[model samples]
Structure formats: C-alpha cells, structure tokens
Target: MIWVHLLIVLAAIFLGARYGSIAIGAAGGLGVILLGATGAPVSREDIPFDVIGIIMSVIAAIAAMQAAGGMDWLVALTDRLLRKKPKRITLLAPIVTYLLTLFAGTGHTAFAALPVITEVAKENDIRPSRPLSIAVVASQMAITASPISAAVVFMASVVEPLGVGYLTLLAIAIPSTFLATVATSFLANMLGKPLSSDPVYLERKEQGLIELRGAHEYEERPGAKRSVLIFLIAIIAVVTYAALISENLNIISDPTLPRTEAIMSIMLAAAMAITVLCRIDPSEILGMQTFRSGMSACVCVLGVAWLGTTFVSTHMEAITAFAGSALTAYPWLLAVVLFFAAALLYSQAATTKALMPTAIALGASPIAAIAAFPAVSALFVLPTYPTLLAAVEMDDTGSTRVGRAIFNHPFMIPGIVNIALAVGLGFLFGSLML
Candidate 1:
C-alpha cells in the first residue's frame, strides 16, 4: 500500500493533469481497491472531507480575489512601493511575498506576486530570476511561519498531544525559516547576475517582454486608491480574526471548526467590502465561471490527498513499525527523512497527516517533530507543485524549469537551510524536548 501511494504520486507528477483532478481521481480509486483487496478496514467516512472543504474554499477565495482584480491592485501597490531602488526592490519583494504567504496560508499568493517582482527586477536591471526565486523561496518559508497554513495546523494537531505548544513551536520555526529565505535570496542574487546577463534576458529585453506596458492604464482608475484601502483593511481584519480564533478568543472554538469556515468568512467579508466600496456586484467579482475553474484546479490535490490517506491507513501498522525501528537507530536523521518525504509528497498537509502520528509513536519528541515540520512543509515549492505549474504556464517563461534546474537557486537551498536552521535553533533555544 505504501508503495502504491508512492507510485500514484509519481504517476500524478509524470502524467501532469491539467487541473489535478484526473491524477487525484485515479489515486483515490486505486487506494480504495487496494485497501479492500488487502482486507483493510475502509469506509467512505474515513475520508478527510473537512480538508477537502478547506482546500476548495481557499482556492475559491483566491479565485475571487483574482477575478475582482484585487490581486492586480495589490501588485500595483507593491510596485509603487518598491520602485525607488533596486536594492529596496530586492529586499521588499521577498518580504512582501513572505507576508502574503503568511496571510493567505498558501504559496499561491506568493506566486501571484511574482509578476510584480519580475517587472521590478526588469526595471532595475536586476535579474528577474533572483526576485522570482526569492518570491518562491519566501512562500515556502512562510508556510512554516503561517499559523493558519495547513501544514502548521496539521503539525500542531499531531504534536500537541506530545507536549509541544503551538506558539512555542511556531516561535522556533518562524525566525529560522525567515532567515533561510533571506539568505537564499541574497545568495541567488550573487549567483544569478551572470545568468541574468546571459543571452536569454538580453533577448527578452530587446523583445520588450519585461516592459510594464499597462502600468498607466491600471493606475488611472479613479477609485483605485479607496478600493485598495478597503481591501487592505479587510485583509488585516481577516488576519486578526484568524489569530484571535486560533488563540481561543474568537467566535469559533471547536478545534474541528473546519479551516474552511474561517477562510470563507474572511473571503466573503472581504468580497462584500470590496463590492460595497467599488460599487460592483459580488457575483460579478468572482463570476460563476471563475469559481468553478478554481475548484477544478484543486480537485487533483483533494483526490491525491484522500488516496494517500487511505493508502497510509491501510498499511499503517507495518510502515509505522519499520519507521520506528529506523528512527530509533538514527534519531538525528529525522529532519533529513522528513525533508525527503515532503519533497515526494508535495502537499505539506497530506505529508503531515501521513507521517506525523508515526513519528510520535516512534518515541520522537513533539518538539523534534514539530521543528522538523518546516522542512517537510517546504516541499510544496517543487517545480511539480500544482500551483507552481499554473504559475509557470501563466508566465510562459521557462523560469520554473530554469529555477528547478538551478536547484540551489531558490527552493532546494532555502528548503535545506530552513530545516537545518530550524532544528539547530530549536535545540539552541530549548524548544526541542531532548
């Protein structure tokens, strides 16, 4: 069953679904068949329907934001802010991307910021690849810092029973992850100069590929500033509400309040505010077509996750036993093991659900496991990530492939450093139980 799960994941990546629906469907079907054939207890109810809801809602909200041009507005704002200096642009790009990931709870937000970063990079004669790489790495790093992120949420649930406090774990993970992102951006900036001066960038420059042609049209809208102000306020409120709820002070209390509920509330509220301020219909903001399209995009992730869960549940005992023995012999290898597992799994939430419990059962400290969470969670930055593929397709630039080829350029280096720094910092700060 474990091998089946891995094979399904590999197939999904290789086959490359347009929206991930086919891959997910295939994986889910196979999981059910294999589980039943093995006489493992399987039921429809065992499926993580709540997770599916959360994924759908978040994707929908992002779609709504995009359709309403909210994303463009935000990008324009970022562009204005970073237009003064190349060095400032370099610093601000990663910081903004990281903040977006923290607030949006997904790397998609960071990817959305890429165009703005790339444009700024072009304007400044800086390598677009450097800022693009920074944006990608920043998003991955922020996944560990984002309390509302699926990875952090899943890890919190798994490690809480083992005596690790959520805030403490986040405290240890956030700074290290942030620093790793900054370090990656700096190093990439140094190395990417040569590549930026290569024929490709020069050709693109001659073709006017990187020029900001529509800046004036976008900035000319009358109420743009007011609409953007409202949007910013709404986002701030959403973040505050999420933090309050997580801290046990908000309206929602049920640990199982379904992450979707919180996210949807924010989405709806933001949509309403934007509509009222801009005098546009809410439905028009995120047309039925766009909503459906976003949902379709997430289907693959949902299916793959469900199938992966089923596969793990079916082979739980054997896999757990084997993992336990292995970890017992080399406990220090936990960070590396999780990093590789995450790279394979792609979905941090799914990876956490699959392996975290087993880590606890293996007598690993909650802190150790939680500290390792960032490493595994960062795997979503892989070029095969569904959101990443979409971003790559959107840009029509081979940056994603190029980025992947230069593994140390962005995702890989930052991911590795995040793990190493997080584990080391956790131990130094006494956040690690051992």
Candidate 2:
C-alpha cells in the first residue's frame, strides 16, 4: 500500500510537469485524493496554510508596488548601472538579479532584467550566456537568503524551537549565499567562447538575425521611487520586528503576534499602504504579472505541500527508522537530498516545508539544517524553469541556447556550482557562528 501510494504521488508530479503552471498544483490535489483512497491517513492541517498565506501576502505587496511602476523604476536603475560598466557585466549581472529577488522575495523579477543583461553583454562583445546564466541562477538562489521569502521564513520557524533564532539563520545565509553567488559569476565568466568568436553567434550575425540593441529605454514613472521606498521600509519593519521578538533578543517577550503572523500582517499592511500612498488602483494589482505568478505559486504550494506533508507524516516512524541514523551520521547528506528534491518540486518553499521538518524530527543538527537551507535553491537542474527559459529566449547572440540534451544547457554548470559552493560556505559560516 505504501509503495502504491508513493507511485501515485510520483505520477501526479509527472502529470503536473506535463501540464505546467497552476496545473502542477492541481495535480498535487489529485494525488492527495488518490493517497487517501489508498488508505493513507490524510489531514486538512497538512495543507501548509501558513506557507501559502506568506506567499500570498508577500506577492500582494510586491504586485502592488509593481502596479505603481516600482518594478520598472528598479529595473531602470539596474539598466543604467549595467551600461556604465558593460565590460564587467558578467560579474555584475548576477548581483543585480540577486538583489532584485532578495528584495521582491520572488525570482520572477529576473524577467525584467534579462533583456537588459543580454543587450549590455552584446554591446560589450561579452557572451550573453555568461551573465544571463549566472543572473538566472542568482535570482533563484537569492530566495533562500531573502528575509521575507517563504522558504526562509518557514525555515526560521522550523529551527527556532531547536535553539536557532531568526537572526542567526539570516546571518549565516545572507553572507554565505552572496559570496557563493559572486564566486559562481567569476566561474561562469570563463565557461563559453567569446561572443565574437562563437560559431553560432557569427552565423546569426552574418544572417542579420542578431540585433545589437543598445540599452533599454524605460519611461520614468512619477511614483516609481516612492513605491520602492515604501516597499523597502516595509521589508525593514518585518526584519526589525522579527529581531525584537527573536529568542536571542526577547525584546518582545511573550508577544501576542508571532514572527510568522507578523510577517503576513505586515506584508498585507504594506500592500494597502503602497496602494493608498502611490494612488495605485487595487484592480491594477490583480492584473499585474507579479500578482498572477504569485497566485499560481500559492496554488502550487497548497497542493504539493499538502501532498508531501501528508505522506511524510503518515510514515514518519518507518522513514525515521530507515534513514535517521544515516542522516545523523552524515549531516551534510541533508543538503544533497534538498538539492535534488528542489529540482523536482520546482519551489524552494514547497521543498523546504515538505522536507525540513522531517530532517529536524530525525535529529539532524539545527545548524546543519540551516546550512542546508540554501540547497533548496537548486531549481536550475531542470531547464524548464521560467527564469531559465526566459534567459535563453532573451539572448539574441545565440550563446545561451539549450542543447538537444536538455540538462546540457548554459544554466546547468553555473547553477550547480552556485548551489554547491553555497552549501560549502553555509557549513563554513554555520561552524563559525553557531
């Protein structure tokens, strides 16, 4: 019966991948039904309502900002900065995308920067693949580092009771992941041939298919800067409140609002503030791309996390008996498992909510689990990720094309290096701090 139920779960994931988008989550719902039918005990509480709620609230605020032209304003700043030093784009592009995701708590922000990275790379005769690949990788990787990201927030909740506080987790994650991102950018710089010498680029140039469009022109929005400032202030408030309530500080002893609850309410409040202060239409937020993608992500987290938690909870004892000692003996193995599961789950938050508790329950060290948190950013193993695909399509130099072998694409090597290096750095920092 267990084997049969597992097969049903795998099949649902396969079907979801085929359907794409919100359907992937819908498929998880179907798997839940099948599991219950097969005699697996299922509970309503397994739905991860908090995780979904955090995603929704964060997305709402980001979407509100986007509707107020804040996203365009941010992208325009990055574009101007990149053009100033096109020769160093390979090194700087990932930093830009990473910062965007870190602030927005969603990698989808990378979409707006892809064209700018490509154009700047071409203008300087640099290979677009170099910057574009690392930029996409960095965007996704930054999720684990972002303070408001569902993955990190959920992870903080998981480890807080085990003697790790929110600030400690952030202290380790932010620096380790940022340094790894910088290191990977340097490595990605040398991966492919120079844009001028690449056969495919040369062919495209000769055929008049390649266009060297200069820097993108973004119309300045009157409220763009104001919206960005409002959003940044909100983020600071979230972090500050979390710190005050943290176990280490205990400034807000026995506070009525928990950190998770604070994040959700603060973000929703921020959304309302942005809407009112920026004079953004509430209806416009519903139509914003950030809102749409974020809602879809909410659905995905709902279904997939529900299904995963149900299975793990039902079979916790057997799972612990089988793998607990192995994990305890090799703590770093947890990072390896997260790295692969993230590739399959396609969501760092979903993967973390699904697996991190099991690791904690199995007696894996808190520091080890926190260190392994960055491994969930391994969304790049599959080229089908939206940011990865967008990078490929945006590069006109033909330097970022995916090979016939799907995993043999531009994102694979740099992404793997980024995750691997981040994990190593996590352990290094985890040791020093914890």
Candidate 3:
C-alpha cells in the first residue's frame, strides 16, 4: 500500500513534469484524487494555505515594483556597475545578478542583468556563456539566501520548532550561496573553447549573427527613482520587523500575529503603497512580467505543495520507520533529495514547501535542514526554466546554447558545481550556527 502511494506520487510528478510550469500544481491536485482512490485521502491538514498566501503577497509587491519601473531603475544601476569593469565581468556579473535576485527575492530580476552580462562578455571577447551561465545560476542560488524568498519563509516555518531562527538561516545561506556563486564563476570561465577559436562561434560570426551591440541608453520613467526607494524601504521594514520579532530577539511584547500573516500584510501594503505613491495605475501591475511569473509561481506552489504534502503525509510514518535512523546519521542525504526534488519540480518555493516538512518531521535537525536549503536552487538542472532559457536567448554569440542532449546545456556544469559547493559551504557555515 505504501509502495502504491509512492507510485501515485511519482506518477503525479511525471505528469507535472510533462505538463510544465504552473500546470504542475493542477496535476498535483489530480494526483491527490488518485491518492484517494488508492485508499489514501488527503485531509485539510495536508494543504499549505499559509505558504500560498506568502507567495502571492510577495509577488504582488514585486509586480507593483515592476509596473512602477523600480525594476528598470535597478537594472540601469546594474548596467553602470558592469561597464565600469568589463574586464572583470566574469566574476562581477554574477555578483550583480546575485545581489539583484537576493534583494528582490525572485530570480526574474536577473533578466534585467542577463543582457548586460552577455554584452559585456562579448565586448571583452569573453565567451558569453561564462558570465551568462553563472549569472543565471547566481540569480537562482540567491533565492535560498533571500530573507523574503518563499523558500526561506517555508524553511523558517519548518525549522523554527527545531531551534533555528530566521536570521540564522539567512546568515548561513547568504555566505554559503555567495561563495558558491564565486566558485562557479571560475568554473564557468574555463568552459568551452576560447570565444575566438570556437568553431560554432566563428560560423555564427561569418553568418553576421553576432553583433557587438553598444550599451543601451536607458531613459528613466517618471517616479522610477521614488518607487525603487519606496520598495527598498519596504524590504528593509520587512527584514527589520522579522529580526525584532525573531525568537532570538523577542522584541514583540505581545504578539497575536504569526509571521506568515505579518509578511502578507507587509507585502500587500508595500504593493498598494507602490501603486498609490508611485502614481502608477493599479491595473498596470497585472500586466507586468513579474506579475505573470509570480502568479504562475503561486499556482505552482499551490498544486505541487499540496500534492507533496498529501504524498508525504500519507507515507511519512512508513518513511520515518524505514529511513529515519539512516537519515539521522547522514542528514546530508536530505540535501541530495532536495536538489533532485527541485530539479523535478522546477520551483524553489514549491519544492521547499513540499519536501521540507517531511524531512523535519523525520528528525532532520534545523542545522542540517537549513544547510540543505541551498539545494532548492537546483532549478538549473533542467534547461526549461525561464532564467536558463533567457540566458540562452540573450546570448547572440551562439556561445551560450543547449547541447544535443536536453540537459547538456551550457549551465549544466557550472550550475551543478554551484549547488554542490553551496551545499558544502552551507554545511560548513551551518555548523557554526548550530
């Protein structure tokens, strides 16, 4: 019966993978019905409404920021920083992209910087794949580090009972992911033949396909500066409030609200403030790219997380009995599981919400679980993700591309190295926090 339940879960994962993106969530709910038919009905307890609310609210604020041209303002600042040191873009590009996504709490922010990284690499005669690959990976890896990311929020809820605080998670995640990104840049720089000597690149050049497009002259929209500042202030407010109310601080004398509710309120307020103060049409936010991706993320988290919870909740006791001692002895194996789960799910937040609960329930320590958090960034294993596809598209040099094998894309090696190192660094840093 457990095996049958597991098979149902696998089939749902397969169907979600086939359906792609937000469809996974829909496929997940169907899987639940299948689970019920197989004599395992998911109760209301299996659903994760809190996680969904947090994702939607965060996305709303992000969408409002995009509609307000705050994202454009940040991109413009990134462009200036990159041009100041074209020679070091191999290292610098990932830093820029990493910080953008880290602060923005979503990898979509990397899109603004991908074009800039590719162009700089091209101007310096560096292979666009180097910076482009690591930059995209960096953007994603930063999500695990971001205090406001849905993945981190989910992780905090899972591990708080295990004695981990939000700030501790951030402290370990930030340095660990940053060091991994830096190491990935070195590996990325060595990938493929030199740009000038690469035959495919030369062929593309002969076809007059690769052009050294100059820097873009960005004209700021009205209130762009003010909007970005307001958004930043909102972020600072969120972080500060979280810090004060954290278990370590205990600054809240009388607390009636869960952190999830607080986060939702703060973000929704930020979105509304951006809409009103920026004087942008509230309707415009719904049309922004960030809004669409965010909504997709919300749906993805809803379905996949609910499905995952159902499967795990049904089988958790058997799993705990079977793998408990082994996992308790070798908790790092949990990170391996997280990496592959995220690879299949293609969503950090969904993957986190779905799997972390079972692991924590099974006795994975807060330290081990938090250390493994970086592995949730494994969306790069498949090239189908938006950032990976965007990196491929933005590169005009033909240097950045997917291989004959579906997973043989340029991001594969660097992304793999990045996740592996991040997990290792996470363990290292996590030891101190523990």
Candidate 4:
C-alpha cells in the first residue's frame, strides 16, 4: 500500500491531471478497500474538516483577489520597480516572495507574483526564469519561517506532545531557511550561466515576450491607487490578526475559535469594505468566472485533503512502526529520505502530515524537523507543480523545461540547487542530523 501510494504520486508528477487523478484515485480506493477488509478504523468521518475549510476559504480569498485585478496590479508594480536595475531586481524578487508567503501563508500568493517577477526579469534583459526560480524557492522557504503557514501549524500540532514550543521551533527554522534561500540563489546563478544564451532566450526576445507593453489596463482604472492601498491594508490586518491569535497575545484563547473562520471573516469584511469604499460593483469584483474557478480550487483542495487523510489513517500503524525502527537504526537518513519522499508526493502539506508525526515519535527534534521543513517543501520545484506549469505555459519558450537542453537553465538548475542548498544548510544549522 505504501508502494502504491508512492507510485501514484510519481505517476501524477509525470502524467499530470489525467493520469495523476487516476493514479491517486485508484490508490485511495485500494487503500479504503483493504482497510475495510481488515476492519481498520478507516471511517470517512475521520477526515480533517478544518483542513478542508481552510483550503476552501483560502481559495475564495485568492479568487477574489484575482477578480479584483490585484494580481495584475502587483505584476505592474514589480515591473516598474525592476525596470531600473537587474541587480536590484534579482535581489528584491525573492525578498518580496518571502514577505508575501510569510504574510499570506500560501505559496500560491508567491506563485501569483511570478508573472510580475518574470515581467521584471524580461524588462531588465535578465532571464524571466531567474526571478521565477527565486520567487518559487523563496516561497517554499517562507513556509518554514512563517508562523501561520500550514506546515508550521501542522508541525506545532504534532510536536506539542513532544514538549516542543512552536515559537522555539520557528526561531530555529527562520535562520536556516533564510540562509538556504541565499545560498540557493547564489549557487543557481553560478551554475546557470550557459542557460542565458540558450536558443529559447533568443527566441523569447525576438517574440517580444521580454518587452514591456503599454500600461496594463487594470492600472488605469479610476481610484486604482486607493483600491490597491485598501487591499494592502486588508492583507496586513489579516496577518496581524493571525499572528495575534496564534501567539495568544493579550487575547482570550478560545479553544473553539477556528483560525480559518477568523481568516475568512477578516478577508470577507475587508473585501466588502474595500469594494464599497472604492465604489466597485460586487459583480464586477467577482467577475463572471471567479465563482466557478474558486469552486474548482475548493473542490480540488478538499479532495486532495480527504485522500491524504484516508491514506494516512489506513497506514498509520505500519508507518509508525517502520519509522520508529528506521530512525533508531539510521537517524541521519531522515532528512534525505524525507526530502525525496516529499518530492515524490509533490505536496509538503501532505508529506508533513503523513510523516512528521512519525518522525517526532522517533525522537526527532521539533526545531530540527521545522528546519528540515523547507528542504522537503522545496521538492515541489520539479516541473510537476501546477504553478510551474502555468509559468511554463505563459512563457512558451521552453525555457522553464526541466532538461530539454542543458540541465543548467535558469529554471531547471537553479531550482534543483536551491533544494540542495536548502537541505545542506539545514544540516549546517543543526536543523537536520548529518
């Protein structure tokens, strides 16, 4: 069954939606059947409903932001900033991604920022892949550092029984993740020189894919500045509130108070207030297609979470038993093993939930596990991630392909090295056992 799960995830990575869905669905079906036959406590009632709610609310908020053209506006803003200097653009791209992911608690926010990062890279004659790589890597790094991210929240929950403080784990993770990002960017730039002169670059340049066009239509709308400001304020308020609640800072801790509910309430209120204040019609804000798209995202998230939960529950005893023995025999193998495991799974959240508890049971440090989070999370850099696919489609230059030409393209090699550097630094920072 474990092997079946692994194969399904790998097949998903290779064949994408059509095959990936079949593979995952089949594996999940088999797991359920086997569990039922064995009389395992694999009831669907055990599914993580809170996780489903979080996913749906997040999708809704992102959809709303997209409909409001905030994403497009952000791209234009990045273009304006990066048009001045390649060096500054190079430095700022990852920094901006890190900040966004820290606040938003979703890599999708960083992924949304990619088009802007790519645009800036184009404007400066820098490879769009360069900034895109940085954006993705930085986003993964932020998951470990962010107190509000799913990985952090999940880790906090799992490690609580191990006598680990969430803040203490976070303090260790932040420095390690930050160092890893810097090292990754530096190493990637060094190895990716040949990619700059690749034929795809020349072709993209000729096709004007690298050129900035007339002002984006969204930027010229009436009261755009005010709307943007309001949106930013709303985002800031949400982050501040999340932090306050997570830390229990001077606020009564309501054990029943759901974080997702709080987040959704804040986002909805902000979105409504900003729309009315800017005199934007609700219909216009939602657009014609936003609802369906948002619903699709919600469904996907829910299905994936349910599938992951089902898989975990069915295999819980076997996985825990194996992890206990394995860790006792080979402690240092945990980091590398988990890295490739997550790469195969293509989902840090799923991998963390499935494996982190087992690792904690085997006496892994919460701080060490937290530090290792980024390394496992970075595994999604494989061309399999939907956002990476979107970026590739948008470019259409084959520049983002994993290994069509040389292994050292801006997107390919840098992403690989980024993961390696992150893992290496995790060990160096005492985040992982060597």
Off by over 4 Å in 2: none
Return the TM-score for each candidate structure.
Answer: 0.78, 0.98, 0.96, 0.77
Clashes of 2: 0
What are the Cα lDDT values of the candidates?
0.59, 0.90, 0.84, 0.57
Best by lDDT: 2
Better TM-score candidate (3, 4)? 3
RMSD of each: 4.5, 1.2, 1.6, 4.6
Show the colliding residue pairs in model 2. none
Name the candidate, 2 or 3, with the larger lDDT value.
2
Per-residue error (Å), model 3, residue 234: 1.1
Q: What is the C-alpha lDDT profile of model 3 across 45-157, one tens digit per residue?
A: 77777777877888888888888888888888877888888878889999998998878888888887888888878988999998898899999999998878878887887
Q: What digit string (tens of lDDT, one per residue) describes model 4 on residues 44-101?
A: 6645455445444544454455555655666566656655565666567777777776
Instruction: Please identify model 3 stretches exceeding 4 Å from their true place.
Output: none
State how far residue 389 of model 4 sits from its true place (Å): 1.6
- Cand. 3 TM to true fold: 0.96
lDDT of 2 by residue, 1-434 (tens): 66787788888877887777898899999999999988899899888888898899999999999999999988889999999988889889999999999998899889889989999888888999999999999999999999999999999989988888999999999999999999999999999998889999999999999987776778877778898998899999999999999889999999899888888999999999999989988999999988889999899888888888888888898889988998999998999999988887778999999999999999899878988888899888877787888888888888999898888898999998898899889989999988
